[model samples]
Target chain A: MTREHLLPENDATGKQSVLDRYDLWGQYVYGFLLRALSSPSLAAELTVSVFDAFREAKETGLTDLLARARETAVAALQTANELRLQEATNFDFRMAQRQSSDDGLLLNEKLGKAQSALEPKCKTILEMAYFNGLSQKEIEGALNLPDGSTGTRLRRAVNDLRRVFALN
Target chain B: MDLKAYMTSGMLELYVLGLASEKETREVERLAEEHPELKKEISTIRKALDEYAKLHGVQPPEELREKLEKSLDGPPTQAAVSSRPMVKPAHRPRNKKFQLGWKHLFALAAVLMTIVAIGMAVLAFDYSDRLAVATSTNVELKEDLSKVSAELVEVKKANTNLQEKLGFLASINTRQVRLNATRRAKGATVLIYWNTDQERAFAQWDQLPELPEGMQYRLWAIARRNFEPLSDMQSVSSPAGDIHQIAFVPGASSFVITMEKADGPDYPNLSRMYLQGSLN
Candidate 1:
């Protein structure tokens, strides 16, 4: 949408209208955060924080605001990534000390293509579990799956991806 | 434990996707710890999911972005996130002992003074800008007023000219003559004003018959002795209240108006005579 649409019809100078226009930047911020966080809900939530920072800064202009917004999203994503790493260690998973690896990026790309090739049900389940970072129980609730079906659906999705990638 | 069976059970995928609960996660960790190969498999699954996400990340709803931005910049966040960076005081317990020293008092006073100075400067700058704008507006208004005053003077001069004409029309020496419309121009009677003393004349009328394009009415003064053509009117037939001057003709006993070329004719077109009158 143009800046005119972002602003109220009558008053473009009003602070509230300016803020309303700023709200449209959330999608961009969310997308940036999602790439780093790998979860839509978390990215969306942090997108709010990024905008809050912008408002707090009392910044103006979409170009400048979006530039600042991307930086804010990156910072929040880094914090979230640290927390996720801490969680993995807290579970005593004994994972390698470092995770932000190039090999992992390659694997994610291959796995993503395989997931996209899966059937609708498998894709939906896998997306909720992997991209949305939802627990099986939460996925079941979100998808309205029958009791105990979430795990079966998740395994089927993973197996489908494995087949596509010729991993099994 | 059947380590090979556990590796193929898809539990690693659940753990990698974060779909495993705290208890399930703990179990997975415990088994992966006992078997290094199991840990490697869990790591591989997690890496795969991360790659998938990087390749196929979905953007949040466009509407949701707006909502989030609103909530961020709106009333809920304004106080906490004002434009100015607020210096947050270090967190301290209410029970912590606090002592104020002279140095502390001086520092606090200095900060307050600085804030006050900044506020006054801002106010002064704002006032200066507003004053400049007001001054410019006043200058524009003055220019407009000057233009309006000049126009008013022109209108007054015009009014005086009209008043002089009216006064002349009301003079004792002015004579009025009613001109009768001819058969061709029925209902087109006209009145003529003649000031004998000033030797000037004008004509007034309510309605005149429509003239053909490039044609006009010409008034002729007919001398009493010979009824010879004297002089034609200077202007075309004028509307009521507006006077059209006719050329002065001394000793003229009558007047006759005829239709002629718009530029007018030196002699009257007797056959096309539209109006005729005799003076008292």
Candidate 2:
């Protein structure tokens, strides 16, 4: 791998470089947010928010770049969750809305149940990656798992989730 | 190299999940670029995940799309391009991979050929050295054979001479005479094979010790009338059983042998007499 391949094509013009990054990774970030948030509007909003934040960061590493995007999306999701809680002042109204949202909430509920139903090790690994937002390397280090096996555990967790979802 | 093994390795699934490390992701991309089947497999896996995500996708609010489009109006910043490391898909031609493979094969073949050539040269040199030694040995054997052949001829000649002497001794006119040892020459005895008809005498020096270096034994023919010296004598080089011809002596009553100086005097040295016998 050459240095040119590793580095961004042009780093001098920070403006155009940021736009290029948004163009390239915006869809991928949106896709990941859609999976995590299960809401296209929120995913799109978070995707834009990630790029807006990425424009200011000086880190050149690609992994760090993706991490920044994930952090932005996760933080936005947390803020939305806090806002939802705050707005739940009317208990009867909230209950009625929750019942109505139950149609869309079924898949989310099923997915969450599938994650929880996974083997303890797989559950922990998936939780670390999705909920805690730890990288596979971080998961390996934190769990004292051997190198290269974190990916294996993640793959297994996803497969197990698929099976659990299918069984339901 | 085993594409099936690579496909089933679970690494591609991790890549799709974005759980793969940067290095592993790059490796997957590199291998997928190199192998179209792997690339197709990656695409299939991505499509499956895409379908799954889309099944649960919700339509975004129209205002968010508009806002995202407006956000892209500015010039490309360093962070934008650098944020997602764009991997330029490498075009690795099959011919290039084939060329590299062939180059390694040729290099291995060249080394093996050199080793074989060296082995053959060593064997040839060793064989040549052994041939030289064998040739030298053959030459020596031939020379020895020739020497033995020459010696065989000399032995045949000696045998013929002995046969002739045996024929002469078998004649009826040949007298076999034994000379007795005298007091001064104890243990000295000789045999005389005399052909009286031919007046020829041959003497055998029997039990004769080797004389001193500068002395020799002489033969003398004695008669009552005169002390007649017959022939000069010396240590014989022939076999001990051989009979040698002396001077012709007739009408001699006795024969005597004596030790004398290497150059014998005309008169016999009586004190150095070695053997005496009467011709009775």
Candidate 3:
């Protein structure tokens, strides 16, 4: 594609209708697959399947995805921004400790509300992915942050969260 | 290989968490698919986590998976598996088998050829669809772009019209005639618009103290031999911008303006000719 084509163009309604067009089903299958697979390449390939499933689902399965999204979106409100912030910071300090390798299992235990060991970033990443129903595109659109920043932050957040529980 | 260290890295957990970057995700996927042991390790970790989350039972509310499945055009996989009829391949009759020879080889070749042909056809069809979509998208965008381009030209045309009118107004040199205060009237100003090129006149009046209960101003454009009243005045309404422009001044010698009652007469009262100016 030419550079000019990549440059932003406005749709008559004063919006980028093209990118928004992908959200037609708003399954945000791309984001779902990204979170589900955790492997970007796998996620992308599955992205096609999600759409393919979506395309085929148009006749049959689509109602389910939409219903699921709605259900999840409503339940999403329970997770707060304050919780998300705390989860990220707690996760990081643990990772920095160079602690034992059992952090993953330990992190799991701490994930319950009873444990204050949760890192703010980990909570943010989870909340961002699950509750907000934001696609990477939406996150990029809303935050103007690089796509990689989210992944990096997520990984770092997870590591820190694990460390707080001190799994290793 | 250090499989233990690799598995211990804890990256697989994030992989399950779906937190990896595209590049990182791609690398993890490539590594998992390429290495069976790594794939097994990752799946093991995921299984453990999935089971764990399941115990907590987000249940994610009723209709969550159903909603997800609907969007995917796929089923709740668990439902798909459980709902499907079990395969009974073992119970099927032992079908007759042809001994492998020239016939089987030809059949194999034809099957391979057919598959290749079908794949090519699918690729061609997909490409055609992509092209059609891209072309339509381009056409839609181009129409909008052209509209944006047209705005600049429209603005330029409007600007030129305004500039030309301003220049036209600036070119004319004009003088106004004033009459001294008389029995009924005081100070007044009239703006006369003259088109030098067309040799025409337009006139309006302002800021004379309000007229008496039934009086008005009458205008006459006078030539050397004859006189014609142009605009007869009504009482002023608003303080400004309410002045009325009188249309069409026939070829003029000079002008005679007078004061009269609000209802003006066909001919000026010569005595009421408050002001007069000549062609010379």
Give the candidate number with the greatest lDDT: 2
* Candidate 3 segments exceeding 4 Å error: A1-111, A131-133, A140-147, A160-168, B1-26, B35-41, B44-280
Report fnat, model 3: 0.01
lDDT of model 2 at residue A31?
Answer: 47
> Which 10 successive residues of model 2 chain B have the least lDDT summed?
B51-60
Query: Could you give me the TM-score of model 2 versus the true structure?
Result: 0.32
Candidate 2 local lDDT, B55-171, one digit each (tens): 332333446545755675654345665678778988776665333577889899999999999999999899879978988998999999999999999999989988988888888
Which candidate ranks first by DockQ, i.e. highest? 1
Candidate 3 chain B lowest-lDDT run of ten: B52-61
**B161-279, model 3: which lDDT tens digit per residue?**
66754554566444333323322233555555555465544555665545445566677775434567777766443234533445445565556566565565676544334444443
The sequence of per-residue lDDT tens digits that candidate 3 reaches over residues A1-168 is 213244234331212332232333222343333232222333333433333333333322223443343233323222222122222222332232123224333533444542244456345544454433333433332223444455555445444444543432
- Sort every candidate by DockQ, greatest first: 1, 2, 3
Q: Which candidate, 2 or 3, has the higher lDDT? A: 2
lDDT tens digits, residue span A77-161, model 1 = 3234433322222221011101324533444555446756787876777754443344454444333355467766666776666
TM-score of chain B of each: 0.44, 0.48, 0.34
lDDT over C-alpha atoms for residue A161 of model 3: 43
Q: How many angstroms is residue A101 displaced in model 2 relative to the true structure, after the best TM-score fit?
A: 3.7
After the best TM-score superposition of candidate 1, give how far the Cα of residue B1 lies from its true spot, in angstroms. 1.7
What TM-score against the true chain A does chain A of each candidate get? 0.38, 0.47, 0.29
Provide all candidates' interface root-mean-square deviations. Answer: 35.2, 47.7, 30.0
